[model samples]
Target: MNKVIDINADMGEGFGRYTIADDERLLDIVTSANVACGFHAGDPRIMGLTVEKALKNHVGIGAHPGFPDLIGFGRRDMSLTPLEIKTDVLYQIGALSAFVKASGGHLQHVSPHGRLGNLAVKNREYAQAIVEAVLSFDSSLIIITEPGELAVEAEKRGLKTAVQLFADRAYNDDRTLVSRKEPGAVIHNQETVLQRCLKMVLEGTVETVSGSEIEVDGNTLCVHGDTAGSVDLAKEIKATLIEAGVEVRKLEEWL
Candidate 1:
């Protein structure tokens, strides 16, 4: 049987009249969308419009919640308590769920955005808090998190989880993503991205930027909607996966 992988993209990050991400075209190529909730990078209008677009495209809708930092784009880390994080996450998910419901769609999953996602992967306490919030809000919603760390914890707690690996981000020898501020953290070459993705799905192994190979479980693959040439890259990746006989689908559909 051909191996299958889920392709997901972050979208709907624009706030008010200001646009930030390159999602307008990226949405067409992805099977699942991580739509920005109001706290991170969206307003009510933008959220509604994004859900509508995803719904029309038959894509799975997911809430993308982040720290309340529109200025830093939610990339800057904040020293927030677990309760604080949980509260904000609930609010963001609630906001996105309302919009998705209004559009006659349902939120299929929840993926924390920016620093929140990175932090959750590295911190067990923080990751648990996030999982708790999602369960408290709605246990049926899928939890999308970094493959090894957060996914393991969520599974232990009986929450359905999808392991998300970034095709555009460099990983450490341990399979953790390199800090975004570091040089060579983000992959710019399309061929390299394609090759890495192929290895992940076919071999279940990825070579880290430091020339170390680590086993990785790629339940869902993330392509940054804001990255330059992201739309083109997504299109190419999809075609390549199909050519390799790798199934490209949403997380729910794949399982």
Candidate 2:
């Protein structure tokens, strides 16, 4: 059997009249979609349409929950207790789950968005809260995250987890992503992105910004759909992986 990997993109981020990214085009290329629930972005119409499109394309649907910070796009840090975080996450998941069920598709995974995602990597309290939230909602939901506290906590709670590698971002020596505010954080060059992805998948290592190699295991790779040329990048990455004899499939298949 050939090696398999999943390609996921953050989608359904538009809110009402304003839209971001070509989610339709992305749905054609990505194996899974991390849809933005109402807390951060996306409204009821966007969510329903996104779920419908994803089901039509046979792509896995995932809930992308974030802090209730629409003005900051959920990238800004928020001060909230563990219980608050858990309840917020549960609410978002429940909203998306209803849409998925209505569309005849199942929720495949849960990926915390923006700052919440960053915190989950190192904050034990936040990680545990996210894990508990997912378990309380649906224990079968796959937790998509990097190799960090979130993944560790999710696995400890007996919830399925999928390690995700970023295709368009730079990494630090510690495997955390470089802050978007920093220089050269988001890699826009297609060649550089492709090279990094191939190396990470085949070699199981990534060269950090500090010029050091670190072990990085990933079952899935993510490309931010809101970025320029995201659909093109996804297409190229999927084609390259398939050509290299790596099966590009949904995370659900592997789990």
Candidate 3:
């Protein structure tokens, strides 16, 4: 069987009349979309349109829940109790679910956004809260994230998970992503990023920041929708995967 993988991107990050990424064009390339659910960057109008466009393009839809920090785009750190994180996540997912249902598309997964996602990596309390929120909503929802505490927590709760490798970020030797604060953390060269994606799928490994390659078990590739020339990059990566005999499918159909 051909190696199967899913390509996902964060979409619907714009609010009001403001626009972020070209989500419409992104839907054409990505197999799954992690639509922002208002608390972070998206609003009702953008969420509805994003889900509608993604379903029309045969792309799987997912809720991207984040901390309620629109100013920092959910990247900055914040203090919140376990109960707060759980309820915040539930509210955000519910908000996005409405849009998905309205468009006649089922929600395929839930991916915690930005700070919340980062905290869940090593924070057991945060990870458990996210898992609890997902279970409370839909136990079948696939938790899409990088391999970390969140992945372990989700599996513990009998929920499926899809591991995603970032195409434009640097990784540490331990399979953790290099911090954005560090230099050379985010790669801009499309060729290099494309090579990393291929390695993660074909060889199950990626070169770390220390110039060492670590084995990675990734079933999905995450493309940044808000970056410059990202639409073109997504298109190129999709074409490259197809040419390499990899099946780029939706997360729902597989893991």
Candidate 4:
């Protein structure tokens, strides 16, 4: 194989009786699961159950933390102090850790969700706060994020880090993800997404929203579960990678 990578998907985003992603199906395909903590979409029971399922599927479990906005699904930006961001992240990770431990699985990574994650790409304060929390809590836990302020902060703090590339989001010329409110922010067409992935992995390039092709960096790919046809997309992406001579491996096992 010419390359080794990890396939990750967000899951456990359903609350109460509602469920989002086809997590069971995804767990079998993806090498890692970025599970939602309670603040966003999951409840205690959901979190616990997600952890158990991920463990059963031999998938690495990662804490997917975001703003405490259940209604917005943590996709909207929130105003908060550095302390608030840091503490909120720590609290969320701790909660997920409990479930992972009880389920006999180790927490492998921390991936900030939605808005918080996007902002961390450029906002130094937000990036620093998240890295500090991760360092204090579990330095061994990799921070799966795009190549930006968050990854830079993690490196400075000497914490394990993994470069993350989104399979379903468009990139800006600045290399940051385009805002969700903007046009073409999320890529939905299956063939376009597949071609984009191939270019990103095999060619190290992605066409930005401004119609510019730029170099991209990443070893971990995230296929957002909430998007329509995500389960099928994840499966195709995995098969495509394997067919292209890329090994699909877990971040915890290989990184």
Best by lDDT: 2
Reference-based lDDT, residue 116, model 4:
91
Candidate 3 lDDT by residue in tens digits, 1-255: 999999999999999999989999999999999999999899999999999999899998999999999999999999999999999999999999998888888999998899889989889999999999999999989999888899999998899999888999999988888888899988999999999999989899889999998999987899998888999999999999899999999988977
Error of 1 at 195 (Å): 0.9
Better of 1 and 4 by lDDT: 4
The 10-residue segment of model 4 with minimum total lDDT is: 1-10
lDDT (CA) per prediction: 0.87, 0.93, 0.92, 0.91
TM-score of candidate 4 versus the correct structure, residues matched by position:
0.97
Q: Provide the global lDDT of candidate 2 against the true structure.
A: 0.93
Candidates in descending lDDT order? 2, 3, 4, 1
Q: Which ten residues in a row have the lowest lDDT in candidate 3?
A: 172-181
Residue lDDT tens for model 4, 1-255: 378889999989999999988898989899999999998889999999999999999999999999999999998879989999999999999999999998777999999998999889889999999998898899899999988899999999898888998898999888888887898899999999988888888888999998999998787998988889988999999899889988899997777
Listed per candidate, the RMSD to the true structure in angstroms reads: 1.2, 0.8, 0.8, 1.1
